[model samples]
Each structure stands twice: as structure tokens, then as C-alpha cells.
Target: MLDLRSFLEVCKKEGELLELRDVDWDVELGTLTELLAEKGGPALLFDKFKDYPEGFRVATDMYTTVKRFALAIDMPPDTNGLEIIKKWRAVDFEPVKPVEVATGPVMENVDEGEDVNLLKFPVPRFHERDGGRYMGTGVAIIIRDPDEGWVNVGVQRVMLHDERTLGLYISPGKHNAIIREKYWSKGESCPVVMDFGPTPLLFLSAASHVAWGISEMEWAGYLAKEPLEVIAGKVTGLPVPANSEIAIEGEYLPPDVESRKEGPLGEWTGYYGGGERSEPVVHVKAVYHRDNPILAGTPPIKPPNYAFAVQVRTTPLLWNELEKAGIRGIRGVWEHGAGGGRMLTIISLKQEYGGHAMRAALTAAGSHAAGYMSKLVIVVDEDIDPTNTNEVLWAVVSRANFEDSVSIIKGCWGTRLDPALPPEKREKGDLTHSVMIINACRPFYWKDRFPPVNRASEELRKKVIEKWVNEIPLLRG
Candidate 1:
């Protein structure tokens, strides 16, 4: 089965992983990671902790690059974000329920009751303004629907409160919060299990925006093409990866009365102060890990955190939704990698008739998966690559007249993390915000009247390249 170590080894063999010894777990570790991430560095594995033993390590930046993300889902090493989405669209995701085992590596060593010390791990204080150290990056939080009997797995920004407490910032209406409320409403406690590290597909699945009632475990297994090996948590009975690096089983506590200040943690939007609040705290009952466990670190400090993973998971779903909505000829759909796959979307389609592109634009803007928090939707002709910003801008500037190509509708679906929303509006369930639609495609009726690009033919371009390769220096500095 696909595990974290096996995935890291693949990245290392491909020269995409960078191993470092004795990296500090304090501010320096996060600073170095941000610098490297901004510079497009390789995956980092920090071994040789200052006080801890050698086996306890921290891994970061696993999904920052396109090729690394490709490796996560078993895609070819050279696949790009768009190509990965196309590949995902072509697959028939056979639902493979996770196989449960009696005992597994995660249970190799267990710290029960009062022995649950979250501080023992190398949880880093990433952003300077972060309330405290967060240990839940690249984590899969498992919670079951008390009524529906369906389990949900998700990754949220979680802060380590103490030896046996973690504060999670689960947004309103999110799967985890939705499931947790179902129990609280019935005067019951929500069983919870938070695993710090799993195979990349598990994390990807956790962070995806799939349809309601679809558990991330099924998505993980579908991506892996086989049932993932899982084990029941001692406290929650929820399924967790059998070979997880670190696992923490707990509950949201009975009566759901406990509350703690969490967040002000940096979000995927590259903004802070969006999620700071007094949220529900997870009371730890047990902690499990391997002998020399590696924590997968994926703090959302800057842009492009796990971009290709988001594209692969969301683009295909959006395209399918569009087709289901009867908007045809959708050549491709892409979510910007740096926007964390939610804020912006682009689509390219062949114009079947009048307002075909408009229909596609509205479909994407109002669709379930991508509509929420999606600020802009740009629809281009099939000839343009929707993923390429320059080509999209060209379409916007050349083909679209400013008056006829733009549409703005207020009070649309919005995100709580949107910094633009006023403070009063943030409260009282004012999640509704505005959205923009940019029709960048050419006019449907006057297609023949449009101007053609002056780009050279491919045959002549290839001939010129050959001549330059044989005679002149290709790059004459």
C-alpha cells in the first residue's frame, strides 16, 4: 500500500527531496521553509532534532511542486497541474472501502490517558503572529456522522493547546464541523481521531472539496486504486491509516461545552487574522506513533501550498459538474495553484451557440464544488490554455470588450476567511459576498470577423529551430 516513507523515497530518488539534519523546531525552521518555498526548493526532511532521538523527524513541502504532487497520486513524474486534472477526469473512480486491520504500526507505541504529550513532537511555530505552535499540518482528522453512519476525513488548521489538547479551526458548514454538530445537537460527544501524517493521497483527500456524504477515505482509496489499510481508533473507533507517522485519538468532549482561543494562523489566502477565535478543543485520550516517526508538515504560510493536488481533485469534479449541468464542449478547467484551489477558476470551451461561454461561466460560478469562495471565473476559447495566465489575459484584453464581457453579482456564496468582508458582516452568518465573471472568449456570432494571431506556423518554427541548432548558437549571450 502507498505510505509516507515510500512516497518520500520516490521523491528523493527523483531529486525532488532535500534532507537536512538538526533543523530547529522553532521560528528558524518555519523561516527557512518559507524562504525555500518562495525560491521553489525541494521537499525538506529535518532529521537530528536537538533534544529528541534520530528517528523522530519532520517532513515538509511534499506537494509544493507539480512533479512531487504527481508522485503523490501515482501520476507520471513530468505531469503538470492541468495534465494531472485531465488524467483524473479520465479515470473511473471505483469506490474501494478501506480495509481495517486489528493492529498496525501506528499502535506500535501508545501513550494513553495522561501520557498524551503533544509537545514531545516537533510541532513548529510557523508564522510569527501565530497564536502558538500547530501540530496539525498535513493531518487527516477523522470524525463520523452520528446519524448517517458515514465518516468524514478532513485537514484543518489545528493548534496545540497543551499535552492533551488541540484547538481546531473548522470553518462553519465544513464536513468536520457539520458532523460534530450532529452529535452535539443530540446531547452527545463527537468522537475524534487526528493523525499527523499519512500517505500524500490521504492528505490530498482530506483537503479536497468533494460532494457531500463522500468520505475522504473512499477518495484516498480511489486515488490509490486499492483499499487503504486502516485500523480503528481506540477512543473514537474511526478508521485511521494503519501506518501513519503519528496518531492522536480523542473526542470533542461530552456536551461540547469546552472552548479555547485558536487561530490567527496564516491561511491559504496569504492573509492572517481571518480565523482567530474561541473554537472547540479536542481532548486527547491516546497518542500513537512508530519508533522513528516522520511528521508531514504543510503549513499554509504562502501561496501554492499543495496546488497540483487541489487542481487534480477539484478541476475534474468541476468539469463533471459542468457537463452534468448540460454545458457542453468544456475543453479544460483549472483552479489556480497558489489560490489554494478555491479562490479562482478558469475554463476553456468551444462556443456551441450564443451565450455558451456565459452559461459555462455561470455554471462554474454557481456550482457546488467550486462556487464557494471562488472570486473570479474566466472563460476562454478552446484554443487558449486556461491554466496559462498570459493567454487568459490576452483573451481578456483582446477578445473581450470591457462593457460586454464582465458581470458582477453581489451576495453570492462567500468564505469566512475572506479578509475583504467587514467585521460585523463576518458575524451573524454573513458569509455571502460578491463574485465576478470575465467572459474572455470571442463573440459567438462574429467569429469570422475576429483577427487572427500573427504567430508563425509550427512547421516554419521547427525549421528555424533546426537551422539555429545546426549553425548558430541557440543562446548567444
Candidate 2:
């Protein structure tokens, strides 16, 4: 969709939208959103905040379900997670540049210089222990590479420090962080344009693990098969989504020049792993928004309730990479949401030879998409369903020999959000951690002699269900 309004209309038609009135922005708003998400509730649009003016709204849980996520990407509502991944993997890699416009609805109400008051919008304190009200959870932070001149759109946490200042936290090795350092090395500030409420397509692209030099805006356009409309920022000269709800043009000051204490907020890993620390601050030069702007909120909730409902974006990348690496007989790939969608991965493949399962596990554990912050990578036979945790666990306990099936690799790529990292290592600037690879497939030497499953065969089960449907109502389910 070109704008969030259109996406919300689709969600409403699909019975996925829920509007709430008179909600408090302090902690109640976030608490209720989390509770609903835990129970797989509908997306929320909060209006008439306890203190803020009416018409200024907040939208949360936009991608809390597979159907909603599929609609955002212009896929059929009934599309499943694996199917979406396969479709994404088949798309071309060429970047589709965004089309620039002179002006758009985002500039309908512009607050420049002294009139930049971020608090005018109801920024919610998402979690009880969050440092302050955040405005950049469901955001796209746009910056251009000083040397390459290619634009980059990324999703990073932005906490409100004041009306005209914001605290930005970009993980080390991220494209934005690398670009910001390039500016700092030249003794200059990094110009930035933050879209506080991007369309669902734009947000999905921004939050994805896109290649380093490619722009997320272009990625979104490529996926949508149409160019997104953008306008040059008045202060930063960066491309801002023309139809975005709320946007700000600012510059990230050098750490020596200015910094702010940030974090202790809940992260996607379900932990406050990145404790409070001094980070770069954004000096907002201008604020642009449409009348009655709606700020999107995507606070990180505990495991099983993630910012994105399913691992629909990255799982396909890993699967494609495995095939490209010459590994064969791949049946499926799944990343568990309980591990923040990156920490735990499960791959199911047919065993063609001895050590085949371990090879697949190692390749996946070290793959570009699964390497970062990965704690465990498990490999199962083609018979197991990787998406189902119970089946994967059963295979692990029944087939895997702990001594021979597990391998640990140390000092792999990791992030500060890893809760298992030792405090001393973190203090020493060592963000690396270990990864465990487990091959849960039966030993290939005696594959033919492996015990048969206790359940009925697929053919027999389907025939019985079809024959008993009229007599047994539960069989339909």
C-alpha cells in the first residue's frame, strides 16, 4: 500500500483492525497492546489519548498475524509463512529507486526551527521500564552514505529526550552506524530524516536484513512492483516518504559534541540487554506531518509476541542461501519467534549421505542471514516439520546423540542484545558469542532400520477423515 491509511482499510475489511478510544499513553497503552498480542488479538488504533488532543492517533500490532503481513505485501490474505518466504526469495535483486515529488501530505503541517515540539503527538512510554516515551519504534531512519552517495533506510530505536531532541541507538555494524561514523570521521554531523509512521511495506523493508549498500526504500519498491513517492527534506536533503504520517529532519551530533543516555528499554530479545549508556543525539531541525497524524508504535514485547508476528522476512533468505551453497534436499526452514526470530533456527532436509545433516547445520549456522546473534541451529530429517516446535523437540530427543550431534563454535557474530554474553566480555567491547549446532536427524548408517513413527500414514489419515467427517464433527478441524 502507498500509505498506512490504505493498509488500515484492508485490515478493517479483513476484520483485523480494532480502534480504541480514551487510552492512556503512559504505560496502560503499552500494557494492553502486549496483552492483546500475547493472545493474538487484532491490530489497534488508539485515539483520544488521556492528555493529547483528539484525532492524533497511534497504531500498533500492524503485523501481528500472517494474514495482515501478507496483505501489507500485497499478497493474498490466506498466504502462509513458508509460501510468503518462497515468493520473496524468487524476487529479483535489482533496486527500484523511489520517485521524488515536490510536496506531499507529510508537509501539510510543517513545524520548523523553534516550533518543533515532538510531544505535541502522543508518544507512548511502551514499557514500564523504558527510559522515556519513544517515537521511533515503527520508524524508518533514512541516511545517505557520505562516500557512496547511496541512501539507506533502517529501523532503529529513537527515544524522546526533549521536544526538539531525540536519542538514537543504532547497533554496531549496522549500515546507519557505519554511515554515521563516516561523517564523524570527517568532523561533520550526520544528517538524518526519520519517518515516524511509514507504510507497512516501507516498515517491513526497513526492518529487514537488507544488503549493506542497498536502500530499503528501493527494496520496498522492488517488492511492491511500483516506486514509492518521496520528498526531499528541507533541512537534511534526504528522501522522506511523501505519504508518511509523521517525519522529522535532523542531524546526529558527534559524540564529542553531544550525547544522551539511552536505553534500558525492552528489546526484541525479551531482555534489557543493552543497558543505559550515552549515545548520539538527534537535533531535530524540522517536523513534518499530515493533519491529525497517526504515530505507529511497535514496541518489543516478550517472546512469542514479537514486533513482527512471524519470521516471514528472513527465513527465506537463509533457505535460498543454503540451496545456493550447493546443499541439496532442503524441505523447509523455520526461525522460532521465542528466540527473537534470530537466535534459534530449524532446518529440515532429507539425508543423502553421512555427515549431510551436520554439514547443513554448520552451513546454516554460519550463513549470512542466521549467523548474527544465533544461539542454536537444529537440523531434522524431512519427516519432521521445522515450523512445529513440538515435532522438532521430539526429533531432537529421540534421534540426536548429544555427544556426536552437537557442535559449538565460539566467537561468532553477535550483538549487544544477547543476554547470554558475560558482563566482563561486554565491558571489554567483545560483543561476540557462541553458537550451537545440533543435528537431530537419525544416523544415516542405519536410516532404513530406524523405528517407524507411531502415527497413522498421511494417506490413511486423510481417507479416514474424509470418510468420518459426517459422523465426527471434530475431524474437520
What TM-score should be assigned to candidate 2? 0.94
lDDT of 1 by residue, 1-477 (tens): 568988999989999988998888887777777888877789888888788888788888888777888897888898876677766663576677899999888888899998889888888888788878989888988888877888889888778999999887777667787888888888777888888988788888888776678787887888777888889877778887898989888878543488888877877777883767778888899999988888888877555754555667778889988998999888888887766787788999999999999899888888877887888888999999988889988988999987988999788877778878778888886977878889888988898789887898879977787768656776233
Worst 10 residues of 2 by lDDT: 304-313
Question: What is each predicted model's overall lDDT from 0 to 1?
Answer: 0.82, 0.88
Total backbone collisions, model 2 = 0
Off by over 4 Å in 2: 307-310, 454-477
All candidates: TM-score:
0.92, 0.94
- Put down candidate 2 lDDT per residue, 1-477, tens digits, no spaces: 458878888889999999999989998999989999898888899999867889999999888888888888899999988777877674467888999999999999999999999989999999999888989999999999989999998899999999899999998777898899999998899999999989888888888777778888988888888899999887988998999999999989999999989987988889989888998899999999999899999899988687344377678778878887889999999889888788899999999999888888888777766677879999999999999999999999999989988899998888888888899999998999988988899989998999998999999999999999999999997
RMSD of 1: 2.8
Stretches of model 1 off by over 4 angstroms after superposition: 253-256, 273-275, 304-306, 427-429, 455-477
Candidate 1 at 354: error in angstroms?
Answer: 2.0
Q: Against the true structure, whose TM-score is highest?
A: 2
RMSD of each: 2.8, 2.1
TM-score for candidate 1, residues paired by index: 0.92
